[model samples]
Target: MIICELKNNQRTDALVSELVDIWEDSVRATHSFLTHADIETIKLYVPHAIKAVPHLFVARENTGSIHGFLGISGQKIEMLFIATQYRGHGLGKKLIQETMSLYPITDVVVNEQNQQAIGFYEHMGFEVYDRSAIDEHGGTFPILFMRKP
Candidate 1:
């Protein structure tokens, strides 16, 4: 697998579409608390988010098939998603480590219901420093704000 940063010119509609598919697949696998309708609603905006995020990185096989991606803005991790089939293969961990090597990422907000993600972040040396009863979209899914210390 190879991890590389995507330039702004590389954020084409086709690439954003592919990333959105990866996002939906990963979310469905991990975000069980979300109803189908919730996923559908959130999916509408994913492409825009992927296109607009300040930084984007992708992990791909030697064959060039992207299996995971991360987005960063300022010091926060705006997003990270790995294709369901790629989970547990250290792709996400590698993406984070690669990003940290290039940027001073200190914050990542996770859905509180995603215990696996919380544990993963904690294992990566982040700790929850804040919480929100509603997500950024004003949804009922709780959010946990974490920081690396």
Candidate 2:
């Protein structure tokens, strides 16, 4: 498997949409810190962020089709998505490793009902630091902030 830098190509369109769908589903299943409008806002940010970063990697086969990607910005990992067909091939783990090589990541997963994701993040060595407070928008749901340090 070759993990190459994310390219500004047509493949990115599907990748962006897939990640947004993944995030939206995660929000619905978990009722997390996101509205549909917030998801839309993030979709707009992908192109600009991808262009600026050299570390966003697109995993590929010897044939060179896009299997997944890892995206990072600031101290945060913005997204990591493996194509459903390519999961369990260690691509997700590979994405995380490559992203961290470029920066010190402080990942924040809010309103996380998905135990699997929580486990995944923990397995990668992140620790919980802070939880959330109730608000009109944030609700009583706890926002868990995590860090690698």
Top candidate on lDDT is 1
Clashing pairs in 2: none
Write candidate 2's Cα lDDT for 1-149 as tens digits.
Answer: 88766555543666656545544444444434557675566557655555555456677779866677776667876556566666566777887887677677777453454455567778888888876664324555455677777
What TM-score would every model get versus the actual structure? 0.98, 0.63
What is the per-residue lDDT of model 1 for residues 1-149, given as tens digits with 9 covering 90 to 100?
A: 99999988999888888999999999999999999999999999999899889999999989989999999999999999999999998999999999999999999999999999999999999999999999998999999999999
For model 2, the stretches where C-alpha displacement exceeds 4 angstroms are 7-55, 133-142
C-alpha positional error of residue 29 in candidate 2 after TM-score superposition, expressed in Å: 11
RMSD of each: 0.7, 4.8
- Enumerate residue pairs that collide in model 1: none
Residue range with the least summed lDDT across 10 consecutive positions in model 1: 7-16
Residue 32 alpha-carbon offset, candidate 1, angstroms: 0.3
lDDT of 1: 0.95
